[model samples]
Structures are given as structure tokens and as C-alpha cells.
Target: MTTLPTLTLRDGLTMPQLGFGVFQVPDDQAQQAVESALEAGYRSIDTAMIYGNEHGVGRALAASGIAREDLFVTTKLWIDDHGRGAARPALEASLERLGLASVDLYLIHWPAPATDVYLQTWQGFEDLRAAGLTRGIGVSNFLPEHLDRVVGLGGAVPAVNQIELHPALQNRETVAANAALGIATEAWSPLAQGAVLGEAPVVEAAAAHGVSAAQVVLRWHLQHGNIVIPKSVTPARIAANLDVLDFTLSEAEMAAIDALDRGQRTGPHPAEFNG
Candidate 1:
């Protein structure tokens, strides 16, 4: 098994920098996908209430025989569960499905600013942490404005901020803000849905490093200090994604990939998405 690098959250909790993600994976297939990822040396698992696959994830975790302390499990609170009262039960239900007493990290799936209830949702997260239901709290798809409001609360700060980040959409402003606030930046869809895999920079880096284009992109993310969760159902690809630790990208190569940023986004804009 690979000895993956770990990042410490602001609250002092540590998790593998490169983890497994289960997005768009059917509930029935999540178990096998996650199991394959575990067999490939992944100890962290990221899922969401909206994914509707926590039960399968739980089954795989239980069957893995990997001790709870060795695993980092994260699940999200959906837009529908965006309120003081709604957040706790939402995570409780997720814990139920995941068959765990508590999750390692629980995040608000999106800001859903139009709904105007994330503040309350965040409070609920804090309460859960105090109650020991989750080890840490965070928000996903949150822009600076949303993060500002939560930070302004000055009660409990977020430990991580997961967002749609990749070579095509670097999300520099958000990344900078997260760094300024001492929050870890987590990259979802880190491969740009395979959109930037064939680009010249990625291809050239892959050729130079004797790796695949996907591995080049993932390596770029890791080198940039961003936590990434790449998802793949194919067994070989899952193993390959975790095999990026053996190589390094030169400074020029890193700059070339950085220049590939054109503000392209594969998902809905954070401020515009109400749900």
C-alpha cells in the first residue's frame, strides 16, 4: 500500500491529501467502486447526501476491515438540508446510511445563497461538531461572500472548503481566500471531467514524465497544495490515480498547466446555483 501524504485541518484533524470520490456513481455500484479504491491504497472517502450512495459506501467500509481510525470519511449536507434544524438530522441520516457513529468531516453541499439559509446551516454544523457527530465542518461550492458571512460569525471556522477546481478553472480567488483564512482547499472534479486531459501542456508533461495525461493533471493539483478526490469506476484507473506520488513536475511544467486556466467551469456557477 502507498504511504499517501496527509494534510492537517485547522482543527488539527489529518486526512489523506489524495482521496476517493463517489460522485455520479450509482448507489449499487458505489460499494464496488469504493472497495476498489480502498484496495488501491485510499484511506479517505468523499461522498454526499445528494449522491444517494452512503449505504453502499458504508457496506464497503465495513467489509474492508480497515480500522475506523485509519479511514477518513466525508459526507455532505444537501441544499434541502440547509437550516439549523435540518443540518443535524441530515448528517445523522448520513451517519445512519454510512453505518458510522460520526463522520470525519461533514460539509454543506453548496452555498445555495438564494435560499439564504447557509448561515443557519453552518451553525448546525458547529453544534454537530460540539456534540461529536463530526470531527470537522466545512462548506462546498462557497464563494468568498458566503465564506465571509460564515467567518464573520466568529464562532467556529471552517476546516476545509471543497470546490470545483481543475486546470481549466483554477478558482484562484477562492483558493487565495481559503489560504488567507487557514482553510484547506479541496478540489472536486480535479480532472475537468477529462476535458483538459488531452491539452498540449498535459500531454507534454505526461510524455516527459512517462505517465498518463490524467496523472499529469492530478500531479499538478497535488503540487499546487490542493487536496484532490478523483473518481473512477475502472479498477486500473482508480489504481493509477493514486500512483502519482512517485514523480515530480518541473517548475516550467507547473507554470504551463497554470496558464491553461481560462475560467472554464464544468458545473454551475456557485452564486447562481440556488440548489
Candidate 2:
């Protein structure tokens, strides 16, 4: 088994750089999928309330028989629950659903700047951390300005910022901003929802390396120091995704993938997505 590298958070905690995500996975399949991922040596699992499968994730965790301290579980607060008063209860509900006393990390799913309540919600995150409900707290889909507001006014720096990134949508600005603030950049749609698998650059690299296009793309992300969560329910893919730790992409190959970025996005823009 490949030992996945871990990234240290600003708060001194470490998280597995390569993890599994349950984004569009249905409730009926999430448990078996996550159990397979765990069996494949994934220590970190990312889930969200909006994904509507936390319960299944919880069931898998409970049944895995893995020690709680050895796993890193992350769940997010949804857009509908974007206020100071609403955040804690939402987290508590998530805890109950996850069957855990506390989570490894808690993230505000989106900035939802349109609502102008992220700062207040961030304060609630701070309160949760202080009260020991979560080991660490962070944000997702937050732009630099949104992060500035939280760090500047709310006074709590996020440990990580989860975003949609891939070879086609590198999101350099956001990644750089996260680096500047010492926040780890986590890539959610690391393969662009399978949009990048057949691209000429990825295919050529995959053939040259004798690996799958998905492995090449995932290796690109790993070499770039971006935390990636590629989700798949297929047992082979679930195991193969973690196989990226073995290979390395050259600088030229890295640059080729970099050139593939055309500002394309598979999901909503942080500045525009209110929900």
C-alpha cells in the first residue's frame, strides 16, 4: 500500500493530501464506496450536507472498525445554513449523522458572499473549534477577498480552502492566494468531472507513462502540491486513484498540463454562486 503524503494545516494538524470525496455519490452507494476507499488505505474522507449522504458515510465509518484517531473526516456547512446562530446546530446535526463525537475538519461549504453572513458564520466556526466540536475549521470556494474579510475581521484563519480545480481549470489565482495565507488548497473536481481524461495532453502523458489518464491528472495535482479528492464508486477506480503516489510528472509534463487551463469550470464560480 502506498503511504499517502500528508499536508500540515496552519493549526499544526496534518491531513492526508490524497483523500476520497463523496460529492455526487448517492446515499444507497456511499457506504460501500467509502468502505472500499477505506479498505484501499484512504484515511481522509470529505463529505458535505449538500451532498445528502453523510449518513451513509457515517455508517461506513462506524463499520470500518478503524480507530477514530486514525481517520480524518471533513464535512461542510451548506449555503442554507449560513449564519452564526445556524452554524453550530448544523454542525451538531452533521455530527449526529456522521456518528462521530467530532469531525477532523469543518468547512463553510461556500462563502456565499451574496448573503453577507460568512464572517458571522466564520465566527461560529471559531466558536466550534474553541468548544472542541471540531479539531480544525476551514472554508471552501472562498475567493481571496472573502478570505481577507474572515482573516481581517473575523480573526480566524482557515486551515484549508476547498475549491474546484483541475488541469483544465487550474485556478492559479485562488491557489496562490491560499498559499499566501498559508491555507492548503484542496481540489474537489481534480479531473474536471472526467472532462480532461481524453484531452490530447493528458492522453499523451498517460500513454507515455503507461498509466491511466486519471492517474496522470492526479499525479499532476500531487506534484503541484494541491490536495486532491477524486471520487469514484467503482472498486478498481477507488483503488487506482490512490495509486498516484508512485509516479512523478516531469516539469515539462507539468507545464503541458498547466497550458491546458483555459479558465473552464465544471462548477459554479465562488464570486457568483450564492447557493
Candidate 3:
């Protein structure tokens, strides 16, 4: 099994650069999928309270017999739970569902600017970390403005910013902002739901490397230094996603994929969404 590379977060924690994501995976099915991923050498698992599959993830973790210290579990607080008193309980509920004492990382799932409470939610995250409920805290789908506000609060800066990033949606501005603020950038929907896999750059690179187009894209993300989580239910696909550690993409190859960005987004826009 290939050991995935690790990222040093600003919070002084090491995170697996490539992890497994359970976004749309149903609650009942998440256990099997996550078990396959762990069996395939995945140590990091990204889930959310809104996903409603934390219990299934907990089952897989327990059944795998992997030591608690060896796993890095990250769950998010949903938009509905973005406030002072709400975040702590939301994470407590998540921990109960995950059957764990504390999560490695907890994130504000979305900024939801209309709600005007993410600032409070972020502050609450700091408190959770102090209480040992989470090892680190971050935000997902947050824009540059949201990040600025979070930083302006004079609290702990976020550890990472997980966003919708793929070949078609590079999110360069936010990525640069994260770097400027010393926050690692994590990418969800890394392959664009297989929407960009068939592109000429991805397909050609796959053929050149004798790997799948998905692997090429994953490699591109890795070279760009983005923490990427690619989700798959199939056992073979789950394993294949982790196989990216064996190969490297050239600067030209990386540039070719970089040219494929078209500002496309598969998820909701961060600014307009309140829930």
C-alpha cells in the first residue's frame, strides 16, 4: 500500500493530503465504502452531519480494528447549526454518531453569508478545539470574503478551507487567499463528478502514464498542493483513487490540466447559499 503524503496545517497538525470523502454516499452504504477505503490504506475520512452517514462511518472504523490514533476523522457542522451554542452540540452529536470521543478536524460546512452567523460559528469552533472536542477546525465552501471575516475576528485562523475544486473549477483566487492566510486548501469533488475525466488533457495523460484519467486529475491536484478527497463506492475504484501516490505529473502535464479550468462548479455557490 502506498502511504499518502501529509500536509502540515497551520494548527501544527499533519493531515493526509489524499483522503476519502463520503458526500452523497447513503448512510447504510457508507460503512462498506469506508471500510474498503481503509482496507485500501486510506487513513483520512471526510464526512458531515448533514450527510447523515456518520454512524455508518463509525461502524466501519470500529470493524476495521484500526487504532484510534492512526485514523484522522473530519466531520462538518451543517449550515443549520452555524452559531455559538449550536456548533458544539452539533459536533457532540456527530461524535456520538461517529462513536468517537473527538474528531481530528471539524469544519463549518458553508459560510452562508445571508445567515450572517458563520463568524459566530467559527468562533465556536475555536472553543471546541480548546475543549478537546476537535483536534483542528476549518471551513468548507468559504469564499475570500468569508475567510477575511473569519481572520478579522482575531481568533485562531482556520486550518484549511475545503472547497469545490477540479480541473474545470480551479478556484485560484480562493486557493491563493488560503495560501496568503497560511491555511491549507482542501478540494472536494476533485474529479468534477467524472465530468472532466474525458477531457483531452486528462485522457491523454492517462494514456501516457498507463493510468486512468481520474488518476491523472488526482495527480494534478496533488502537484498543485491541494488536499483532495475523491469519493467512490466501488472497492476497485476506492483502491484506485489511492494508487495516485506511485506516479507524478510533469510541469507540462500539470499546466495542460491547469488550462482546462472553466470556472465550472458542481455544487451551490458559497455566497448566495444560507442553508
Error of 2 at 121 (Å): 0.2
Per-residue lDDT for 27 in model 3?
96
The true-versus-predicted C-alpha distance at residue 160 of model 1, in Å, is 0.5
- Candidate 1 clash total? 0
Expressed as tens digits, the lDDT of each residue in 234-273 for candidate 3 is 9999999999878888888888999999999999999888
- Global Cα RMSD, each model: 0.5, 0.8, 0.6
Inter-residue clash pairs, candidate 1: none
The reply for model 1, stretches above 4 Å from the true place, is none
TM-scores vs. true structure, each candidate:
0.99, 0.98, 0.99
By lDDT, the better pick of 1 and 2 is 1
Global CA lDDT computed for model 1 = 0.95
Order the numbered candidates by lDDT, best leading. Answer: 1, 3, 2
Error of 2 at 49 (Å): 0.6
lDDT of 3 at 1: 67
Q: By the lDDT metric, which is better: model 1 or model 3?
A: 1
Residue 162 in model 2: lDDT? 96
Per-residue C-alpha lDDT of model 1 across residues 216-251, encoded as one tens digit per residue: 999999999999999999999999999999999999
Per-residue error at 11 for model 1, in Å? 0.5
Model 2 residue runs over 4 Å out of place are none
Residue 209's lDDT in candidate 2: 88
